[model samples]
Target: MGIRPLAKARTSFAATFGGLPSGFWWLWTAQLINRACGFVMPLLAFYITEELDRSAAFAGTVVAGIGVGSLVAGPFGGALGDRFGHKPTLVAALGATAASMIALAYARSPWALIVGAFVVGVTNNATRPAHNALIADVIPGKDQVRAYSLNFWAINVGYSIAMLSVGLVSFTGYTALFWLNGATTLIGAVMIATRVPGRARPAEPTEAEEAAGGFGAVLRDRSFVAFVGAQFLVLTILLQSESGLPIAMSLDGFSPSTFGQVAALNGIVIVAVQLPLTRLYKRFPESWVLAGSSATVGIGYSVLLLGDSAWIYGVSIVVWTLGEIGNTPTSFALVARISPDHLRGRYQGLYQVAWTGSAVVAPLVGGWVIHTWGAGPLWIGCLVVALAAAVAQLGIGTRLTRRVATKDPEEQPEPAKSAPASDAG
Candidate 1:
């Protein structure tokens, strides 16, 4: 609360940035630009209802299209990165995303918009697996945790700026929003294409290697599967911010601008505290931090039941934002740790499936529930989901790191290893 914790955080912050590669900053820059310009998803529900005069159920379906895109793209993207390398995969995905956003922006009909949404999801969402593989390739083992944290920090900083801007732009019209989104995505693509050099893809696995580990390898890893599933449960509720919260706020007579203000609370909180939270979380067991995060996120939504005022919503956002701050970097670091370096892309892609599933299903389920049962029931349902996610996360902790268990950032995997570095930086 005082200068003492802030001072310590500043010290830890310096340590987090020390010794990272130059390429990482470029990656971070692209992330900042892409997210900074990200405008569509946050206000998508409003665009559909207020701008397009669509039903909430139909809006949910459109949002679900994004999830479908991520689901399809995530694994394919990871495989493409595994085979073709990271830089090219990133360039293609980002370029395709720009085109999809442009398509979505111009689509005049509901069916067209729905198809555009799905295309956006496919082209855009795969960026994660490609990105994670690149991080593993460029960064040394010791710095993976902080590297991912810094990358995530870029995402939210841009996200905070984008949300605030989108809130204001909503007053003007949505056309500009789509154009800006596509432009920024194109810019990010250009940066990576021009600046970031490519790494060679991993050699194909031998027959023995294929039998023991390959495409379906991650699927057979029980602990990793559990971790991804727990993530699915929690993301379902957290993603509700994209659609559920907006819908609820509008029903309460709030404007999209007000929704932007409330949602900005999340990005603001993360940007402010991510460094300190990183420092703080480094002190605890990763499992404990992740479990606590799941619990906190649930509690944040339950707070929604208490009131519907702007300040109330803001406080709820801050509460869950803390959970987000802790959960995200920890999960990324853990994914890097548990995943053998050779198959990190596949692992990340598989892990991403949990989030993809949530994005695909959460909005549809939440919207249907809200439509059928109203706001109160939706809040109650979030509380239930939260409990389930927390338990599942806690249970997975006992089995999380069977192959590699070093918690210190100083540790490094041996050289000339097999797929262990497949997830490499």
Candidate 2:
């Protein structure tokens, strides 16, 4: 019995993860390294309010600096990646991320810490546009969803490790948190520089293509823009898991260690179910999948109104994590499908802006709500925003279906190559 189940598990693993290109795996490995110690951002609120002895409002402002930086980086990073090369862009950005993290660790003064957070946001986010672009560049479109799903799983796995480590070690201090994060980010940079291939630049755009490309063209995409807006709404709710949720728990008398354990549960649930659900969700329409997932996230967070027990928070995290599992990879795949190859980076960058941009708004609003009113109103508001986002997503789904039905043969994206050229190590 045990032997048969073990064999079945092996087969499932192979079916789920097998056959990606070397470059994709290298990219996956690099991201795993970077995220494995990605504890700082999630816990930055605690560090500021508890360690620095700042107010919740002040922490929100500092955290908002990351959003400000991300908003700036998204479009520019994508444009640079499109104009130059993804490999070089990632190398420079990751190196900067490492330096900025170290700088953030040592910052003591209010102004210094605020500036450090902003710089950390810029360098940390600048890689995302190129990262997603490279995936679209290399992976066959049919495989991009699976690749992204696996990547999401890797992210949660890393988050689980990071959070659990924080629970274990954070009592010592958070200085090591920034240092470890920086070191891992630097290693990821080295991995990219040494192992990933420099993608061959595409043929220069023709007159029509030139007219349609760049940030102007991306902005002109009304459908994509609306989709981004819905994304922003949903992210405003989800990002609270990192920013507002921790502070809420702390105010309710939980320790940072307790918060870390609960936050780690979010990752643990994702690590367990994300891949399997990815396959399951693929069977449904993208729009309905997203709508349902958004609703699920809202319901999950709303559960917080019931109580403040560790068990209640754990349930909240798990329920929302299920929604997150369905939402992230499915949404990314949809974005990839809708985007033109020439504008993949910008599309991804704009997509990233939805999340980072929410970081800007969600924290400021959530902090104020928690400080001024209470956590109750904040959780209530999440449900309202999530329902609105779900409605918007359904409209997007209908439009996407119509767009596909009406698309001309010539309008279809050129088939991507099986794999990108890699630098021989």
Candidate 3:
């Protein structure tokens, strides 16, 4: 009976993951490698303060520059993908990211590091829209959620490994982290450039599609624009895990290794529950799921106001990580659903802007809050912002759901082999 149950679980897992294209798997593999080797960004605050003896405020500025780069990269790369091809955009971004990482590693002065960080941020984030667009292009709409969910799972698994390794590697010095990050990124780029099929141009948009595919059309999407705003607010809160949380721990006398341990909890929790939760979350409406996720994030961060220990931090991480797991793939899937086939790259680019823009905002504000009122106030602010975003998302999500149901009836998604018919997003 136990063996039967185990076999049934295996069958269920296979059913859930089966029927994705070879291209998506290749992209997935590359993303996993890129994320595992993505070690530099999270440690930047420490490197600036501990290694270079810089101020937290200065570190915030440098981090803000990363967001600025990402802000430009989102639309630019998406345009490139739409015009030239997703493969070329992805390859170019990855290769540029590798070079920038090396440049950033060698940079010693404040001005040099800031410039390098901006360049690195551009090259690194330029991959997002193109990568997402390609997935949408190749995968059927029905499977996109599952594909994204699996990809998100792979990302966290890699993140877990990377965060866990940060402690051991930091004792050696930050230089190695940059070098390994560059090497692996370059390898992933090469793999994609060689393995993935390259197209000189995407299929030409129809007359109507051409008219609808411009940035103006994307801007005219009132629901999408509002969604982006709500997303921006939620991201401002969630991204603090990367930007503010570590800085707070450091201010509290925590070492880099200690910070790494606590940070790793985010990825660890995601790794354990993302897929199972994906299955569960699909049973609920996206509006409720996303709104609830934001509220959950607010509640999680509020845990910090009650205590000041690593255990408390760990507990906070576990709660917020659950929100992150729910939000990330669902948000991506929603963006894909809202976009037209020909304008996918453009729509995805603007969506990327919301995230990158928030990355810019979160650190500056978080640093100020921490520096002025301390960590308690910062977390309190997160709670308030997150709850507000939740309310906004619920309303927006409900509207979008109605729009998606009525608007895209012509779309005939490919049939799955044995997968459940539920909308996984």
Q: Provide the TM-score for each candidate, comma-separated.
A: 0.82, 0.84, 0.85
In angstroms, what RMSD does candidate 1 have relative to the true structure?
A: 5.8
Query: On residues 4-65, what C-alpha lDDT tens digit does candidate 1 reach at each position?
Result: 99998777757878777778888889999889889887777778888888899988788778
Candidate with top TM-score is: 3
Each model's lDDT: 0.78, 0.80, 0.83
> Which stretches of candidate 3 lie above 4 Å from their native place?
43-64, 105-113, 166-179, 197-200, 247-258, 370-377, 407-425
Residue pairs whose backbone atoms clash in candidate 3: none
lDDT of 2 at 375: 95
| Count of residue pairs whose backbone atoms collide, per candidate | 16, 0, 0
Q: What is the lDDT of residue 276 in candidate 2?
A: 77
Task: Compute the lDDT of residue 407 as modeled in candidate 2.
Answer: 43
Ranking by lDDT: 3, 2, 1
TM-score of 1: 0.82
